[model samples]
Target chain A: MGRWKNGILITYLVAIVFPFIFLFLLSMSSGWRFPDLLPEYFGFKNWGKVAGTESGIAQSFLISLVISLSVAVSSTLCGFVISRYVSYHPKKRLLTLLTYFPYILAPVVFGACLSYYFLKMGIFGTTFGVVLAQFIIAFPYALIFFSSFWNEKIKSYEDLVATLGGGSLTTFRKVLLPMARGLLMVCFFQTFLISWFEYGLTSIIGVGKVQTLTIKVFLFIKESNFYYGAMSCCMLIIPPVVMIYINKKYVFNKLI
Target chain B: MFLEVHDIEKSYNKEAIVSELNINLEKHKTLSILGRSGCGKTTMLKMIAGLTPIDQGVIKLDGVRVDEIEASKRNIVYLYQEDLLFPHLSVFENIAFGLRIKKIKDHIVDDRVIEMIENLELQGHGSKMPHQISGGQRQRVAFGRAIITNPALLLLDEPFGSLDAGTRKNMQTLFLRLAKTFNITSLFVTHDLKEAILMGDEIAYMDKGKLKIYKDRSSFINDPETGVLAETEFWKQLKTEQF
Candidate 1:
């Protein structure tokens, strides 16, 4: 039984680690054919060209960072505030049900549905347009994520603060924000991931003009440039990896 | 009267939850309100604290009309049954919360919080987090947090309900000591008949949203509606039947 468990664990670890190792090796190699076990060239030749303008992956990475950060921040803060009202509202159930509306339709269809309004607002091919589009999807997720935060106990805490002579701003700054730090970090990371990896919505709203990293990955794949595709895929996993590390090291440990 | 609640009424969906509630409590005294669950004790306390909006009533604190004021401005702290210590803060910080909110100077806050921690008999536990403390210690922290604020009135809704009997007795004694030390005016709501008689300088019984304040503890014990007679009879009958 012990051996069987060890075998399953090893297999699972290998399954998880295989893609990452393959992506790294594939990103560093070129001119490899199917019959060849390894590529003819495997070094930093492609890696060094990342900073040059030819690939533009650096610019794509930066743009993707900005869009995701904006969406994550706005959506997390708005969701935190809005979820409180929804939690205490008389029609709490109805309001909660409305948060799931964006997920009802697929992202591609949702983006397509919003294309007309995007064009009408004259924001269709802009970076701001992509941020707004991703926000539409990410915001609801954050709302649902934070809906569990407000309850009778939290309500009592708020009232307790008020009666202790703390005003609304003071109450939030002193009590609510401190209490919610861990959940807020978790929500921000989740929303950032949602915006970071969003592909279909970016393509429709950005109109091939705003080349985020995800779009660049697809573009590379479409042009049969597997090396660059693998490289961008490698880059795509970095932020989430760092975020997970920070969350584990700082947030979850303290929460536990 | 230090706290005045006049004709306060609260209703839900056209049904009255608390109707024509009235209370007059003097300064530096505790008014113990005895009522069972769903008897509008909490609603009455919330209205006085300005947490729940009253349908039609006036509440005065220190001779000033507070019904129209925000809860924060009313200077009435309401303690729940739970200790509700802020998890992110240390015991010292939890006690110091109100002072920080009022933006009191750091030195004064330090002095007062240190004094309060000692007063709460939680000297070395000041650096500990809420989860690290015992239930009795947590309740002491909650009380320290509230009393350090020096509010005009304190409303405690069965604040020691979750404690074991021994701890509850100790907390009651501690509360009386602290209340006298701080000269705190409060309305203590509890279902325990013994606790009501022990905690209150003035006692009141609530039934169906109306409160009847007793002239004295003897009167409170004599009033059958207060249920003291039945409780006494049960104790007497138990004493005779056993062994």
Candidate 2:
């Protein structure tokens, strides 16, 4: 029984790790057709192309980073502050229910519905437009994510700070922020992931002009360029991978 | 009176929670307000702390009106049933939080915090986070944090309610000693009958949003509405049955 369990564990590990290894190898190889055991050549040539302007991978990576950072920081901050009011509001239940309205429809449908306003505002096909669309989805997620953070105990802490001769800003900086550091980092990581790999909303709002890394990956896939697709996929996973590591090390461990 | 509250009122949804609340407390004294749960004890304390706005009242501290002041500016500190320590801060930093926010000199903060740590009997634990300490220690840290600020008033909402019986007894004793040493004026709210009698320089009883201040400990014990008479009978019956 123990041997079978160990075998299952090993299989699970390999299953999860296989895609990452395959993507790395596929990104570095080219011309491996049917009946061929390996690619015609395997080198850093494809990786080398990422730095040059011809591939546009670096540009896509930078754009994705900027969009994700903006979305993450803005959503996390707005969510943290607004969630406090929502938690304390007289109409808290109704307000919270409204936050879920964004998630009620599919992102593509939501994006399509929003495209009209985006076009009217002359922001369609712009990076800012894509960011705004993604934020619409990510913001609610952050709001819901931080809803559980404000409880009776947290309120007591705020009151205690007030009584201790610290104003609202002091309470947030000294007590609330430090108490919520782990949750804030976790929220940032989650929202960053939401914005990083966002596609449908980005596609509709970006209008094929604002090529984020996720869009580039889909573009490569559509053209049937497996090598570039694999490379873009590799690039797309980098931030999330780094974030997962950070969330684990700094956020989760501190939380525990 | 160091603190005076007159005809304070609070309501939720047109229903009264605390009504006609009035209190007068002298300097360097403690007023223990005893009540059962949901008897407006917390509401009254929060109102005094400026945490909850009073629908109708005037509050004066040291001959000046404080009802219009913000909680932080009012120089009042409120302690909850739970310690509510800043989990990310160490014991020293937690105790020194108010002083630091007030922008006291670093050396003064360090000296005062160290002295407070000693007074709290928390020696050698300054570097420890709140989670690293026991419940009684956390409660002590909470008290120290509040007292270190030298507030005009301290409101304690059952500060030791979560402790074990032994720890609770010890805390009660420590609080009495600290009250004298720091010259602290406070409102100590609790549901426990004996704790109310022990902790207060003056005693008041609350029922259904109304408060009646007792003349003395004997008067408080004699009041049936305070539940002391019933509690005494129960103890007497238990003693008789055990004997």
Q: Give TM per candidate.
A: 0.97, 0.95
What TM-score does the first chain of candidate 1 have?
Answer: 0.96
| Model 1 bad stretches (over 4 Å) | A1-10
Give DockQ per model, in order: 0.88, 0.85
TM-score of chain B of 1: 0.98
Candidate 1 local distance difference test against the native: 0.94
Please name the candidate that would achieve the greatest DockQ relative to the true structure: 1
* Global lDDT scores for all candidate models: 0.94, 0.92
Q: Which pairs clash inside model 1?
A: none
Q: For candidate 1, what is the DockQ-based docking class?
A: high
Q: How do the residues B1-243 of candidate 2 rate in per-residue lDDT, one tens digit apiece?
A: 888888998999999999998888899999999999999998888888888888998999998999999888999998999888887789999999999999999999999999999998999999998889999999999999999999888899999889999999999999999999999999999999889999999999999999999989999888788888898899999999999
lDDT of 2 at B231: 84
**Model 2 Cα displacement at A140 (Å)?**
0.5
- Name the weakest run of 10 consecutive residues (lDDT summed) in model 2 chain B: B220-229
